[model samples]
Target: MKSKGFGKKALDLLFPPRCQGCGKLIDRDDGLCGACLAKYGDEQRESCPVCGRTARECSCGAAALGSSFIGNRRYCAMTFYNEYNADSERITEKLIFRLKRKNSSSLTDFFAREAAAEIMRLMQLSEERPEEWIITWPPRTPRAVLEYGYDQSEAVARRISYYTGIPWKKMLVRTGGREQKGLGAEEREANVSTLALLRRKEADRKRFILFDDVITTGATVREAADLLYGAGAEAVFPVCIAKTLLKEKTDDEGVFV
Candidate 1:
């Protein structure tokens, strides 16, 4: 006789759920597929909230770069993409690998959900009063967006907005700046922050969290934040999916508050 267990029934109903990470069929309902999930299990690790590195390194790492415009501000993220440099600067670096090449729809959702959960945690821990939190990512020039087909940062942010219920808008634009990822470590540090502005409307709200897929040099996001601050935004906090955990010297401190 067959077992009448509900677990067996649920499994049959889903009939081999697909994995979010590698796109393989799995026997569970977890966030990721088995193989792909395990592959990145080690890839994704805890990051420092203060500096978006490791918890232990947060003290020194964040303090060293705490001189930039958004330096002293508080933002929460699930992981840090900037840390990918120590390992590799390849095109498929960090979140780019899963979201782009793998074509994993669930993968981006996984990131958004994780980030939303972290944000919730931070709000509870710090007792941040929720007036209104807008979620926006670094914008791309029309030419760049046409070239890439889609901006992975904004795509991930869109999914995040759906999951977290936080309003996201096109409040920041990108001026013609050097690609932060392609630059060498030193060049990445030397590039100045230049955030383009978005015209405001009647329904527009302030107090926002800038979202990005990854934060390597932090220059790109910093530039975006500068633009928002200049446009009468009450506050701008950045949230990247992943951050660089590697050791490096920073002249600009990544932020200035």
Candidate 2:
């Protein structure tokens, strides 16, 4: 019989791998080339330790509000998508656009691995690593699924589960919601409150980590966490790959702005 390695080599020869970030030819099927990988590394390292904002911005307020609805709940994210910083914003937009539009599985896998590592690190810092933590994600609206042909958040969550050795299940169903883009914080919160319903059977799990792609006003995750808490989840930790920085309003004086 032919060896498995021989089959793999034949496939590689037929279809050489390309970098997920730039579509450049590469040796492997599952990651960016050195330059693209370095970009991610630099962003991760430069992001704020507290709220994941880039070095000059402070947006911990939004991060703080992530768990406001659920007392004592923790929230964490990988990096910031700051609109004020053109470069940071552009990179974030590109990453998300590629994931949602192209459905780049290798890119998704790369992000999932990073997120899983962060989740583990956070759990370790808390000193309460549960033996079996349930991994779940906020479901996209059915309309979005229809438009995108797949759910990006779910895709990332499943990959994270695979990387972390944790099981992932669909624990929430999005009933309805208008698109959250361009909405103010208050409107965003109200909109998401009616967006999701928990799956009772799955909700019985003790601990859950709910992840999403980007956290803007944090309304979506907050509402999702509330639903999970209501469904009897002992704890719900919100995780995301990128966070949108809360833009500060300032007057002409620029004092206390």
Candidate 3:
């Protein structure tokens, strides 16, 4: 009541900003504009040279299915982390925040559309028979899900179904283990720390592709593969929308799952 009107006016003026993805004006949302949806209409569709995964550049050397002694198959990524735009990266970062803080399941639609677009493209590129394949993502522990309200990764997997014409199996359960952070590549690469397990009645011979928005240490997928194989998935491989390059980076992050 003392001087509320002037301060409120000044605060509004100072906070006025445009959406990062598109130049549109908005009352609240940032990072992405309303029309900044990802379109793969002109993206490259060639298979990768080094690993047979799909990509224009063949920089991959990750272990293949038979080589892993576990991983079922390998596939291509629609984009490298390098291709991520500033606005998109911000949105991605926001998703991590929303998951970590708000823990809202509603954000799935916002994050999954971007991921789904990329996965749909991957399925489109495969020469394998076109039938519905099982879908999955790393599951969060019951404690984490309850603490955060929902599993963002699972929410992401659910969103992917509509675009990929696949079904997600709710066959995995988390053990509510410790989080992986500040872990090195070597340790991460050899991680035996898995926090999830498959349901008893779920089919073991089911074909499925695991999903993750990010794949930094490779440990997350590596650990998940063990549980999945044990569950009886005939084969299971990962399908990330973006990949990290081997080149020294400037830390300018980009679009994410």
Candidate 4:
């Protein structure tokens, strides 16, 4: 029998691995090359989206999140993202696009690790135990799931569960809807009818951490939280790999919905 290492070496020679961000050949098939990896997490938050203060100094309360549907709970994200920026300038956007186009365990795991740390920090500050919270995600549209053969958010949630030791459950379902990629804020808000509760009774007074790949207009999460609240969830704290930043809005203007 051939050694697995030998087989891998042969495969690499046959099909060179290219960086997902820049198409540069890399030593391994790890989604991104050294340069792209170094560039990751380098984008400064600049200021807290909830408050106008510098990110490192801001101490806004949960109610400042500006989402009445979440019971004034806080949301966490690893980085800020802007869909309008060219992927060349925003490697995170490229990673997100790649993840949506195809599932990559390494990529998803990377995102989950960061998100897990942030979630833990928030829970610790709030004196909430991990076991008290359930990990869940706003399921992707059925059409996207069928096209990609997986829900990227679900993949991230499962990995986060593994990192944080929190149990993950499928609590929401998306029947069918047009993809929200290019839709405007109002269009996205009006598109919430597609989502429905999957485990309605299971949500009773349960504290949930909703995970997702990226948060754009916040429409999807708002709708998801609404469903959970209606299902009797005690609270829903959303966590994501990236949060969309509105460049036109100043820090004092509140970037999130």
Best by lDDT: 4
TM-score of each: 0.66, 0.76, 0.58, 0.75
| Cα lDDT listed for each candidate | 0.58, 0.69, 0.54, 0.73
Ten consecutive residues with minimal summed lDDT in candidate 1? 63-72
**lDDT computed for candidate 3:** 0.54
TM-score winner, 1 or 2: 2
Candidate 1 lDDT over residue span 1-257, tens digit each: 26666565575585666665444676765556655555555545555444464531243234332222233335443444543432353322544555643434556677777777766656556666544677887775544565556767777788878877777787766555465666888886766444567665411346777887766666776667666666667777767665565454443333322
lDDT by residue (134-154, candidate 4, tens digit) is 999988877577578998999
Off by over 4 Å in 4: 1-20, 23-34, 44-73, 84-86, 178-193, 248-257
Model 3 Cα lDDT, one tens digit per residue, 1-257: 26867664465487654454344665653234554433232223434333444442333534532122121226434444443344344344333444445544334555566566655555555554325477887776555665667676777787777656678877566663343456687765654434566674474777667777655545677677777777676767676555544343222222122
Off by over 4 Å in 2: 1-8, 47-59, 62-73, 83-89, 177-194, 249-257
Residue 168, model 2, lDDT: 91
RMSD of each: 8.2, 6.6, 10.1, 5.3
TM-score order, best first, reads: 2, 4, 1, 3
Segments of candidate 1 deviating more than 4 angstroms: 1-17, 27-31, 35-73, 80-95, 100-104, 175-195, 200-205, 248-257
Tens-digit lDDT string for candidate 2 (1-257): 28776686687798787877667898887768877878776776675555445622333554343432122234666666664332334555567667777677787897898888877776676666546578888887775776788998999999999888778978888775567777899887776425565577567646888889877767777778878878778777777787764345433222111
- Candidate 4: clashing pairs of residues: none
Error of 1 at 21 (Å): 3.6
